[model samples]
Target: MASFVMKQMVGGKLNEMKGGLDSLTGGNEGEGEKTETGEDPEVVAARLEQEERRKDKHRKMEQEREKMRQGIRDKYNIQKKDESGGMGGFDMADGRIGAARKKTPEELAAEMHAEDDSLVGQLGLTEHVEKAKTAVNGAFEMVKGFLPFGK
Candidate 1:
């Protein structure tokens, strides 16, 4: 008996929620509140304006992101594939965005070699300096051992 009462209460609440949603959405499944045959001119204009604003926002964001990516590429000495004689090298200039191309194995290898050589030169010099310091320290210890001194 309690379960039956609970079910009826739940069903009534669900119906009320559905009615609220329908009212918010202009009540009809296939048509809005204006009419069955045509849309309001003002509503249409508003929707178009909204869409234009959305596109503008998206374009601005993409331009900002591209600028940051360009800066990073410049700092790392990464070559832009779009630098060839063609205007559409990496990104096309025709206002159409395209996916980035995957780099070739050879290109990857070359970049890796360049980066590795720089790292090796830096680290190798540091390691040699540390070894020289250790040798000096050891020589100082030997000299102190021979000195006639007391603590």
Candidate 2:
């Protein structure tokens, strides 16, 4: 889903670039710069496309953040939409909630460690994702090994 949104954003930007290039070349680029409302055609299209891309990016970020928030809530046995309301934003942060609830550092540490073990065991990730993660991580480490810091 995120990838689809990203692709849409990239495609939209490419189209906008092409439009701008054609506009720069000549006023005879078919659409000219006149709108039905007597407004600038190029400006209207550019504005509309920018708005669409902005909305798309916002929706994508919300979805990705919600997924992460729900994952954390699941680990801590919390509700997705409890009586207090949806904790989709910063209110569900681990450190903030931990402090408010009086969870000690050592206790939080243990919980985090246990959560890590269960997460890898129960995430239900596909074999393809696991393989891709391995490949990506290996690539990352290979680059890191060649860093100027001489690790």
Candidate 2 residue 58 Cα shift, in angstroms, is 0.4
Per-residue CA lDDT of candidate 1, range 1-28, in tens?
A: 9999999999999999999999898767
In model 1, which range of ten residues has the least summed lDDT?
85-94
lDDT of 1 at 40: 66
Cα lDDT of model 2 by residue, 1-151, tens digit: 9999999999999999988987898755555556688777777889999999999999999999999998999899986566464243334556565234446799888985676456464675445566999999999999989998749
lDDT: worst 10-residue window of model 2: 83-92
Off by over 4 Å in 1: 1-37, 83-151
lDDT for 89 (candidate 2): 38
Report the number of the highest-TM-score candidate: 1
